[model samples]
Structures are given as structure tokens and as C-alpha cells.
Target: MILIAESGSTKCDWVLLDTLNDKRINTKTKGLNPAILKKKEFKNIISDNETLSEYKKEIKKIYFFGAGCNTSKTKNNVHSVLNSFFKNSTSIVEEDTMAAVYATTSTPAVVCILGTGSNCCYYDGKSIINKSISLGYIVMDEGSGNHFGKELLKAYYNYQMPQNLRALFESKYDLSEKTVIKKLYQSKTPNKYLASFAPFVFDNKEHSFMETLINDVINLFIKNHILQYTDELKTVPLHFVGSIAFHGQNYISNQLKKQGLNAGKFIQKPIDSLIEFIKKENAVLQS
Candidate 1:
């Protein structure tokens, strides 16, 4: 049996492939970002998942692709935790961008992730070359869920948001300064807390405010991340992976056209496609 996982800062999706039964079991768990989470937290999260715990010994191999696993330190941190839990299994840990690349294209292209956090890399058919080092959600993540959430909060507080939208936003969430401060500064998972506000923006996207907001964020992402691969964009398509990119495809497409760049694909969840990609690779190896 094999376990494949694709994780963001907010959530992790797992698929257990049972070759003998020719079946797949899907499960969900909270994000396990080695950069943000403690070693004990990783063990706790996996142990708390009934499905993962029950099938731990049966899982011979584990492929984990997630945010914050880019560096050797972070990758080894996650690898150690997984090996401790899945005693019989050997784990392969990699950055989330690898999963995005595999799921979107085998050919050379600029792949971007716009989920709880944002990142971009140029996959040159065989290797991932990241020009910009992501400083994480605080200093970076231009057009991600957390970025949008931060913008919304600023607009609401500065009285820049439309009156009607302000009313709706206030009614939907606790906008009190105390609560906001506590969540942003006091909470362990501040990135996830900020991303929670992104659903409201997506839900009310029909509004003019949302349209402008989306365009602004997408433009920043293109300018900062996509444009870094300016030379490559002339030949290769820019592929996006994650929920924010999935929801903002139209805006992204329009923005790309204005820059004279090509838009390839928008994948909301990469786990399914990543699973198929791995299967094909295994088949080719065996053949």
C-alpha cells in the first residue's frame, strides 16, 4: 500500500492506495507545515487521524508534498516525523511546488501555487528553479488566501470597503480589534486564521469591490511572481495550482493576456492529478 499526501498551510489531503484491493481511501487532516508546526505536533496530528493511524503499518511508502518542506531542514523534520509514525514505511518529503509541477505539466513551464500561501517556480522539464525565496506568509505570499484576507481586513478597518459589503463582513465575522489581534498575534496558526477570511471574498465575488480586489491581487502576483519568468513566459504557459488560483482564473487569464503571457491550467486540488502522475511514473518504470 502507498500513501500520497498534498498539504497546504490550512489542510492536508491524503489518499491511501491499496493495490491488492484496487481501492483508494481518502482522508483529511489539519496542515502539518514543518516550518510552522513543532515535531510533537506532527506526531499528534497523524496519530489523531483515525484512518492514518489504523493503516500506518500497512502503508509501505509515503509520499508527502507540502508547503514549508522546501529546505533540507524542513524536509528532514517532516521525514523524521512520518518515519516515526509509519514505522514500516519509508517517506519521501518534498516541497509543495513539486506536486504542483507534477500535477500540472511534465513539460517545462512556470508553475505557481496560490493557496494559503503563494510561491512560484520554473520547472525546466526536469528540475524546479525558484528565483525568489519565499519569506512565507508574513513578508510574502502576494496573491494567496492570506494576502486577500489581509487586504479585506485593511479595507474594512480603513473604511475603504463599500458600506453594504462592510455590513455583511461585520455580520459574518468578529471584527473587533481585540479578537483580530488575538488571532493574528496570539494564535499559533496565524496564516490559517487569516486564510479563513478568504471564503467571504470568493463568495461575494460578484460585487464590484471584489472584482477590483481580485484584479489588484492577481496583478500583484503576476508582476511579482509570474513576471520573474518573463523570458520563459514567451514560450511556456504559466500554470497555477491551488484554490485561490482556481477561483481567480478569469482574472488571472485576463491579467496574463495584458502581459502577453499564456495561461495553461488552474488546478484547485493537486492530490488527484498527482496520484495519477505517480501511477504513470510507476507504470513506466515497471515496463
Candidate 2:
């Protein structure tokens, strides 16, 4: 058996693949990002996952694809926590971007993550060979949940938002831009706070301004990040993952095709491909 984890900035998806039977049981736990999660949150997630102790003991390997584990320092921190619990198992840690590649065919393609945060890479199959900017939450993370939320708040404060949408925002958050600013600037885990408004975008999909807002952000991500990976303007099959990619796929994919980039498959979560990968790989090991 193999244990797998795919973590974004906000949460993680876990699966225990019983290689022997080719069955995968799914579970979800808290986020595990070095940049976003403190030691307590990280420890908590590990504890809850280890609650599957029967599976934990039976599992032979653990593969983690975690966001914000970009540096050796970050990777080691998450590794330390995971290793403590899965002591009998082997653990492999890689950045969340690589997980997207693994979620895809592990081929030479553009693998993107559009979620709480957005980032892109040109996966040469063997490795994610190169990646574009993930300039943190402030300047980048375009085409992300937080990005959508930020736009929603902007429209609300600027009075450009439609009345119905504005009312929803008022009802949900009940905070003015000034209050939001104070909270965002003065709070901890500000990214989570920013992402809080993302639901409003979906709730207000009928509003033209919301469409424009979504389009602008998705376009910026394609132009800045995806385009940067284009090799001599040759179109590459771009695969997308995460909730933002799932929800805003039409707008995001159209914008990419408009620029002559071939938009390929979009998978909301890596769990399916990950299970398949482990099952297939484990078969070879057994044989």
C-alpha cells in the first residue's frame, strides 16, 4: 500500500492506495504549507492523517506533493513532521507544482495550478524543468481564489459592482474596503482572509463585471506565466489542476487558446492520477 498527499495553500487531499487490491480510500485534512501553516497546523494535519493508523502501518511508502515546499528548508520542515508519524514508511517530498505534473501524464506539457494561489511550469515529463513566477499573494497569484476575492472586494468598494452582488458581499462579509484593509494588513494568515471572498465570485456569476474580473485575472496568469514557458512560440498541451482551474476553466482555457496555446486536460484534484500512478508503479515493483 502507498499513502499520497496533495496539498495546496489551504487544505490537503489524501489517499491510501491499497496496491494489493487496487483500492483507494480518500480523506481530507488541514493545510500543510510551510509559508501558510504554522507548526501547530502542520502537526495537527499529520496527527489527523495518522489517525488512519491501520492504513498507516500497512502503507509502505508516502508521497507528498506540497505547496510552499519550494526550498530545501521548507521541504525538510514538512518532511520532518511527516516522517515522525509514518516512521515505518518511506516518504518522498516535492513541491506542489511537480505534483501537478505527476497528476498529468508526467510528459512535456504545461502543468498549472489555479487554486488559492496560481503558478505554472513547463514539465518536460522527467522534471518540471522550469517554472514561472509565483510572486506570492501580493503581486501574483493571478487566476486564484484569493485573486477573485480581491477583485470582488475592489468592485464593492469602487461601487462598480452590481447591486445584487454587492448585497451578497455586504451580507457575507459586512465589511467596507477600509475595514478589509485593516484586517488584511493587520491580520495573520492574510491569504486565508483574502480567499474568504472567493465564494462571492461564483455567487455573482450573472454579473458582467464579475465575468470581466475573472477574465482579466485568468488572462494575466496565461500571459505572464504560461507564455513565459512557451518554447519558440510552439504550442504545448497545458494541463490544469485545482478548484480555480475546475470552476473558471472556460474563461481560463479560452484565453489561452486565443493566444494560440493549446489548452489540454483539466483535473480538479490529483487524487485520481496519483492513485493510478501508485497502483501502476507498485505493480511493476511486485512483478
Candidate 3:
């Protein structure tokens, strides 16, 4: 059996393919990004033998694509967490951007991930040659759901929001800015709290404020994240994965086209492409 996962800060999608019978069991797991979960915290989640039996040990091989699994330190931390789950399974872990590349097939392409956070990588079909800055939540992460959510909050609290939008924001989220602020500043995992605002953006699609926010997010992404990678942009076409990128596809495509850059393609999920990746790899092994 082969166990594969696509993890963002918010959640993880797990697919366990039992090759012998060609059966697959799909599951959803909690977020295990080391950037968010410290080593001790991760240990408790995975090593909590009380619930391990539910996950089972039928998996023989494992592949993980995740956010915060970028640096070796973080990767090892995440690995330790997952190692508990994939106990008898051979696990290969890599950054979430690699999943975009593997799913997109490493063409001369720019892969953008816009879930809780954002990252852009230039893939050559063989390697991730370049990656633009993803300075986490405080600095970059422009064009991401969290970024849009944060902007919406600031607009509401700063007395800058129109009355209609302000009312909608308050009624929808039902969260006080003071509580939000304390959570964002004082919590162990602030990004998770900040990302919680994404639903507000989704719920208020027709609001002019949303349109402006989208435009601003797109502009900042192109300006600071994409165009900033001057040396790499010329090398490939752009492809995007994630809920926000897929939902805001038309707007993003139009924006990039306006800049005369051909945005490659967009997909709502990576599971299909991932299955294809495994099939192709299996073929190569057989050959």
C-alpha cells in the first residue's frame, strides 16, 4: 500500500492505495506543519497510542507534501510526527511546493500555492529551480486566503470599511477584533487564527470591498512575489493550486494576462495529478 498526503496549515488529505487489491482508503487528518506544531506538540498528537489503531499499519510506502516542511529542521520535526503514523511505511517528505511541481509535471512552470499561506516555485519538470519569498504571515504570503482575511479585518476595524461591508463582516464572523488581536499576538499558533478569517472572504464575494481586496492581493503577489523573481519568471509559465487560487481563478488569470504573462492553468485539487504521478513512476520502475 502507498500512503500519500497533501498537507497545508489547515488540514491534511490522506489517500492510502492498497496496490495488491487496487483498493484505496481515503482519510482526512489534522494539520501537522512543523512551523505550526512544535516538536513536543507533534509528539503528543502522533504518539498518542490511544488513537493510533484507527490509522492502521497497512501502508507500506508514504509520500508527504506539506507546508512548513521546507527546512531540514522543520522537515525532521514533521517527519517525527508522521513517522508515528506511517510506522511500518517508507516515508518520503518534501515541501508542499514539490507537490505542485509533481502534480504539474515539472514543466517550465511557476507553481503558486494559496491556501492558508502562499508560495511560488519555478519548476523545470526535473527540479524546483527557483522559489520566490514566502516570508510566512507577518511579511509575505500575499495573494493567500490568510492575507485577504487579514486585510478584511484591518479594513473593518480601522473605520475604513463601508457600513454595509462592516455589518456583514461582523455578522458573519461574530469575532471581536480585540479577541482576534490577542489570539494572533499571544497564541502559540497565530497563523491558524489569522487563517480563520478566510471564510469571511468567501462568504462576501459580491461585496465591492472583496473585489478591491482581491485586486490588492493580486497586485501585491504579482509585484512582490512573482515579478520580484525577475531571474526566474522568464523561465516558465504559471500554474496555481489551492482553494483561493482556484476560486479567484478568473480574476487572477485576467490580472496576469493584463501583464502579458500567460498564466498556465489552475486546478482545485491535486489528488488526480498525484495519482498520475504514482502511475507514471510505477511505469518507469517497470520499464
lDDT of each: 0.93, 0.79, 0.77
For model 1 the TM-score comes to 0.98
TM-score of 2: 0.91
Instruction: Note the residue pairs that clash in candidate 1.
Output: none
Clashes of 2: 0
Rank by TM-score, descending?
A: 1, 2, 3
lDDT of 2 by residue, 1-287 (tens): 78888988778888887766768788888667887677667877677665456566676788888889888988888777777777778888899888888778755787888888888887765776655546688888888888887887777778888887777678888586687877799876677678777877866667788888888988888877888877823745778998889888888777877887767788898878877776777788788
Model with the higher lDDT, candidate 2 or 3: 2
lDDT of 3 by residue, 1-287 (tens): 77788888877777777666878777765767888888887666545533334655766677888889889998887677667756887678899889877777646777888888888877766777554556798887888877887887788778888998778777777667678878878987677777788777767778887877788788788887677555666766778888888888888888887777867778767766887798678668768
Q: What is the lDDT of residue 54 in candidate 3?
A: 60
Candidate topping TM-score: 1
For candidate 3, the 10 contiguous residues with the lowest summed lDDT are: 45-54
Question: On lDDT, who's better, 1 or 3?
Answer: 1
lDDT of 3 at 29: 59
Angstrom error of the Cα, residue 56, model 2: value is: 3.4
Regions more than 4 Å wrong, model 2: 176-183, 232-235
Off by over 4 Å in 1: none
